[model samples]
Target chain A: MRTSITRNRILTVLALAGFVVFLVYAQTNWDAYRLRILNLCAVYTIFAVTFNLIYGYTGQFSLGHAGFAAIGAYAAALLTMSPEQKAANFFLAPIIPLLRDVEWPFLPALLVGGTLAALASLLIGWPALRLRGDYLAIATLGFSEIIRVLFVNWQRITNGSLGLKGIPDHTNVYWSWGAALVTIFVVKRLVDSSYGRALRAVRDDEVAAQALGVRLFTHKMMAFMLSSFFVGVAGGLMANLISTIDPKVFMFFLTYQIVGITVMGGMSSLTGSLVAAVLYTVFLEVLRPIESPFDLGPLHIPGIPGMRMVLFSTLLLLVILFYRQGLFGQREFSWDGLLNTLARLHRRVTGLWGRTPPPSTVEKGEQ
Target chain B: MSRKKVLLVWLTLSLLLSLVAAGPVAGQEDEIVIGVYEPMTGPQAAGGELTMQGVYLAHEVRPEVLGRPIRLVLVDNRSDKAESATAVQRLIEQEGAVAIIGSYGSSNSMAGGEVAERAGVPVMGCSPTNPLVTEGKDYYFRACFIDPFQGRVMAKYAVEELGVEKVAIIQDVAQDYSVGLAAFFREAFIELTGDAKGIVAFTAYQTGDQDFTAQLASVMAKNPDAIYAPGYFGDGALLARQAREMGYQGYILGADAWEAPELIEIGGSAAEGILITSHYHPEAELSPASQPFVELFMEKYGERPSAFAALGYDAYMLVVDAIERAGTDDPKAIRDAMAETKDYEAVTGTITLDKNGDAVKDAVILKVEDGEFKYVGTVKP
Candidate 1:
């Protein structure tokens, strides 16, 4: 009971600390462009986290996350844009009466997009659940490719890859981070619950889980639908942040990149996934400036332009080979642990000087 | 328990280490930075690399602009729309680039344009032929003529010069460039034919699609007088070879994106008699500037220059010329100077920016025969 209480206190302190730091950082350095990238990272965090809920936790390989994202993006885009803007952008806007009159507000449109994506996942999941491993990957890949092809050919709805533009820019860091935080909280709670254990059991041994009264297909389908809902919400945020949606936006490479992040972050670890999302985004951003060839004094080094990706892929491969459990594994950061670490370092330095540490450090060191 | 503490300490140390990794970018007042954002890797890498090479060479030969050393900061978009947007933002906010040049693909260019316009930076595109790039945005401009005019020019060439009555289109549906050009071509072709049903058949393939057999079979069945495939030269060349192998005897025509060295190299003997609309022709020495630009490009790269390289050169020269005319890095003043640009001797042609920020230049028609793009003539669009 005491250990549990201490754990809860540590978690609360850490959460509060993180929230304070995020608020300070976001306010101090928040420009439209930086906010835009922050919003993107938040959206992808939600995506990666929800994707981990299924692929990482439940051990289902899905390559159709982009398809669900596309569905949500197009639905949200079509719903939120003013009728006049839609008419101006699309020639066939007036042909469909339901679409012509429909201009749902941003939040409701996002929910509606999420609902549609969930429905799509349910529909696709019914038959897809029968397959396993490589077959399942292939089916999901084909599903995404088909969705892309349909979005391209269905000019009346998607504008035929000319893309839906002039979407209202309503996505902000508050909306994105708020949604991501709530999603992470809810998913963490769910994963720690009995339901999550059952899901994992199904993942580990399907037949045994079924013999133990777990409904395999239903549980998997539920997880898939839930994952799709969060992914859809992320997509809605993406559409608003970018203020545009194209078939090209939902390319297979995007799904692969997220998958790479998932592997690097350690499957089934929510904290790992979140850290990976931020790390990946920031790494790409920072490396972009230094990726080119530069000259320092007498050295005229040729710019190897695409060397960044080579480095990233190599790092990813190394991570997979060496640190297979990823950076955090299943563990999360706690403030008590951090404070204790600081206290211990202070103690070590004080010991070297043959003196007592400060009261604050001693207090933390006792914990 | 101690293992967990050690892990926590490691995590905290790493987090702190990330902070130490951050560095401040020291800028020199004497140097002018120009940001070049393009798809340096991915499907559009070839085109972007060509454009970058052109810009790099331009900077090498003429390192100083307005008596300040010009530095080119190139950022890769990875051919993704979101990355392109972020790249433009970084270029404007972090690099403090006075002017930006980019983004060969239409979608990528549009993504970059949003950020550039919002940041109040002038983005001179190398070869993004979409009219929408500068339709309403004052900050966005390109060296190449818009696709609508290019489409109309090709339509007129096919109908009036080649006397092709029936034309078919096989475009890359995923590419806004190909789709927009195809639409314009269809509109112009139908208007020129005076009949809505003038096109024999229209088909499409997705970008990065290797097999064109199914698409070609459908187009070949129509047996049109000419086949127009407005896609990147890689896929366009492959389609040409595939169509010929499948017994297509009609004239193959393509848009400006089909002007690459790989088209001839990949299509080989099958590339013969393939006509394409382009902006530059090394053989067509329209102005005195063309000779020196071509000579310098060949001297540096040791290969014949593609239209993309020429446009990249022109885009840089136009921005530099505007900067020289404005006598300041003020975006609005530079924009005004860009609008006032006329008879600017570029490697591509003598350029004049219209009120809409499009280049008013002639389009050259070239045909591949014996693995070389022989310049036919120029069409004033």
Candidate 2:
């Protein structure tokens, strides 16, 4: 047991050291496009992990991620944009006087955005958490639609649909990865606590959990608010990284992406979320070439538009069909699992050299 | 063991294929590269393809400048702002482009413009007519007039030519193009009629909304002489069909977004007699330099080029002209030369860049006659 603990400690230190090396390498070597993609991967990692916390670990399916993200994005954008830029972009109607001259740095804006999202979840979770399964999904989706419509008509605040531009490009690898790490650590700690068992109890059977004195509403609301806060921070990072945003960017499709990532990453596994985030982001960039024409010597092959979506959906369908419990099931990657796999392979290799079949089996083979 | 071998083979093959498909190595001294960013795939693909036809045709005709082959590196923006910014970064940093042209939608162009502005590279927009696109940017320019001018032109046409005193407005609230144009049109319409109450009704609907019965009912009750619906083709056509079904027979006026063939295909018979203000019309009188381009475009595509295509062609030509005038491949010099453009002959019209990097030109008024966009007249700004 002591050796196992020492091994785990060594692994953690090594993993952190590797991550630091990668960050330094990326900072020095990557161009702007590659760096942007890397930053997006970290931001998506935060989003996917938080989404898994609510929908997978807590089993409370909510489709209001995009609305919460919009709240956070607009909050961060409005705070970060200079007053002059606000005056320029808001030509249709003037911005409210309270927000006109407001400009905060990146960290404070992100914190405020996350806090606001948590507050919003507090309002939404009160009524919506009472419903179960698909009804809850529909209610959350309806709220998201309402949020989008409100943003569209509220021209004085959101600049209508024209959107705000010239947001400062303040996001970098450190900010994105730093936020992602904090989210992962917090989520992991929460899931390992006593309340996490209560959440699982509520997820498995709400009536039984209530009989055992577990307050389902409080546990679900905790997961929901925590998820909202982290996802909100992710939205702020996305807004600042791209440097422009509109209501269109926070459509229902954005929630679909988060859900897709959480499911594809094995839902309940934090490590799965990390792996899926990097894999999915890199896969998207790699598939862009398929949407572009390429020349193969004498032959010129034209690209088919929308082929990326087709291929992506097909891969996702294959994953869902083959792995009903997701790639990792309810288990996470551990050094013990890796060591067992290696030991099994070693035994097989040694047996190939030394083992002989029994006489009864040999006779059966001959027959 | 065999399965592992197969996987290894597949991985090696994929790696080899990727190496072959990678972009060209940097510092190709013989070719002077110019980047083109467009929404080659997605909801805006049709507009992007039409606009690209103009740029491709211009390249076919004039492939060389300053004794070097001009190579255009094209990247798809996916009709998304974030992707557009990344595409622009790739163009400036990796492709070593001296100048860039692009982007059909105003938002995408504005996104790309921010990157180009930061990188000290010039971006010439083809059909992005938003005034904010070049408002504070030093390196962004466009070949088309902005929404404010276009909106005023449509308002003047409806008030003076159609003799409509009262109008109703339907805006697509989710789209920047729709909202910006509607705001300007409302302002101009009120100024022309000398009364704020001239706009009898103003209603709004979101982008993907197909059921306009409620807004149409509200608008029809106003009893206005004309209705202005300035939006994309899909929503605008549906709105027109719904309005006609409701038995409101007032004249329908539209803006440049109505110039696509989808308007006729979707609106059907209701699209006829709808007057639109656009940047280019196939039947309009063309300058001598524009005649060959029009003919070539028709022969190549077997269809009349839309205003987006014409602006795209003019954008490319304008960039080439600036490069020639600058007498070098330096981006800053080309930008300065582009800013000094005056009376430059383009396929759309004679363009002169104002102090704000917008073109001061005339807009064509079109009518949907015989299931096609027919030229009615021109409105000068």
Best by lDDT: 2
Question: What digit string (tens of lDDT, one per residue) describes model 1 on residues B1-381?
Answer: 344455456445534433332222344678877889989888888889888778878888778877888878888998888889888888888778889998888788877887787778998988888666676678988888988888888999998999988888988988777888888888999999897767988888888899999988877787799999999888988999998999889899998877777888999888899999889899898667998988898899998888888889888888888888999877778877887889888888888888888888888999987788899989986
Model 2 residue runs over 4 Å out of place are A303-314, A321-324, A338-367, B1-15, B23-28
Q: Pick the candidate with the highest DockQ.
A: 2
DockQ of each: 0.33, 0.39
lDDT of candidate 1 at residue B167, scale 0 to 100: 86
TM-score for each of the candidates: 0.91, 0.93
Which residue pairs does candidate 1 place in steric collision? A293-A303
Give me candidate 2's TM-score against the actual structure.
0.93
lDDT of 1 by residue, A115-224 (tens): 99999888889999778778878898888888888988888888887787667777877778877988898888877788899889988888899999999898889889
The alpha-carbon lDDT assigned to residue B129 of candidate 1 equals 81
Total clashing pairs for each candidate: 1, 0
| Full-model lDDT for every candidate | 0.81, 0.85
Evaluated at residue B222, the lDDT of candidate 1 is: 76
